[model samples]
Target: MSFHYETPLVDQSELAQARAVMGAGMARILGYFREDGARSIRAIEEAFTQGNAAAMVIPAHTLKGESLQFGARRLGGIAESIEQTARRCVEQRLAPSEVGGEVAMLRGCFNETLALLESAAPPSGTPRPPMPGLAGTRPVTFGTAPRTFGRRTG
Candidate 1:
């Protein structure tokens, strides 16, 4: 495995694999990634603002893993960089200020990655076959609310 550093901004093969694994629900999975990624970016920013090097580790690490899962190599690379640098800073009792530039760049990377990810998602209104092994469940698709089977009672 070459790892995220050597990978492109988005590895199509890895993304295809993710698509294969996520099946009809891939769009929802991507949306969740976007939400989690944004939260992680904010956490990283907050850690930098507080000058808490240790605080950056968890969010950065989380971002790095999630990013890689979706083939967002550049975002993963930057998150890994922040995570590694923060770890060193914590070990050496230094501020995480050195990563200020990267911290600033994280949002932009995330936005770009979001675009790439969105583009990779299944186009709206694609028909979904029924999910296996889950009785009485509906497959969620984009641009519409998930289907409900039982009669509504509110």
Candidate 2:
């Protein structure tokens, strides 16, 4: 079954709430989300490649929740589709190929979602005003160097 998102790709309200709750910690959390989402996407793609329907569940499920945490509805919806379809395929002894197309689309959705998220995220490695007690100490942000959002092969 195909999925369409009724909501925006990224929900600003959810992000705003997260930012309000987390304050400056939002950058670190976004960094964690970026890393974790990529790893989970890789796992899901690898499982699909290996024809392991069972292996697809965890990563897809992980991606679904984490995507929602960042207000990424489209990515979360695609991931949920993968997770549910893979689970059904496993139960029915169907090949992972049943869910192959969605699996193939997963990374693209993730990249799109990441682009939106990164746009909303504070710039990593950019200098910020020093904290009250720590003069001349630039706040450290966690994340890799900026990427072009291109899908990595291999």
Candidate 3:
């Protein structure tokens, strides 16, 4: 049997809600990145690099939730690993060596996921669909930036 991957994030209805929310914040979304998404990723990487597990966990959790909401399954999966590892380290006080291994794993996962997301193409021969209810609204594009819409607490 061929196996298929399923995303753990939003369903179609939830996605619609997420899109509506994101549309409302379209003007401020890019600015949220500060450095066009690079800064946020760097901050997350540095937190992991420094062994600040709590910080790493928080950022990863936030990124994962947002990514899932926006249909970014691969990125969300990578972030989920980071979050899980960080949580293990922080909550269970895992050994430094274990945490180091976890960090390395997360880095690899993130890189691979990023590569896949970057290479993904829009469905061939299909025109891009218009955003629901966004007619006449200024179109906002993130270009190559990875983004998602979802709730984040804290």
Best by TM-score: 1
TM-score of 1: 0.75
Which of 2 and 3 is ahead in TM-score? 2
List ranges where model 2 is wrong by over 4 Å. Answer: 5-7, 122-154
Comparing candidate 1 with candidate 2, which one achieves the higher TM-score? 1
- Candidate ranking under TM-score, highest first, comes to 1, 2, 3
Measured on C-alpha atoms, candidate 1 has an lDDT of: 0.85
lDDT of 3 by residue, 11-124 (tens): 446544544555545334423422323444566678766767777777777767755654556556666766787788788766323344434444444454444433332333
lDDT by residue for model 1 (1-154), tens:
2243364788888887776567657788888888989999999999999999999999999999999988888898889999999999999999999898779878988998889888887765565543446658776656555666798534
Error at 132, model 1, angstroms = 18
- Candidate 3 ranges with C-alpha deviation above 4 Å: 1-37, 95-154
lDDT of 2 by residue, 103-136 (tens): 7777777788787777776655544444346777
RMSD of each: 8.2, 11.8, 11.4
Question: How big is the positional error of residue 15 in model 1, measured in Å on the Cα after superposition?
Answer: 1.1
Clashing residue pairs, backbone N/CA/C < 3 A, model 1: none
Estimate TM-scores for all models.
0.75, 0.72, 0.47
The true-versus-predicted C-alpha distance at residue 147 of model 3, in Å, is 33
Model 1 worst lDDT run, 10 consecutive residues: 123-132
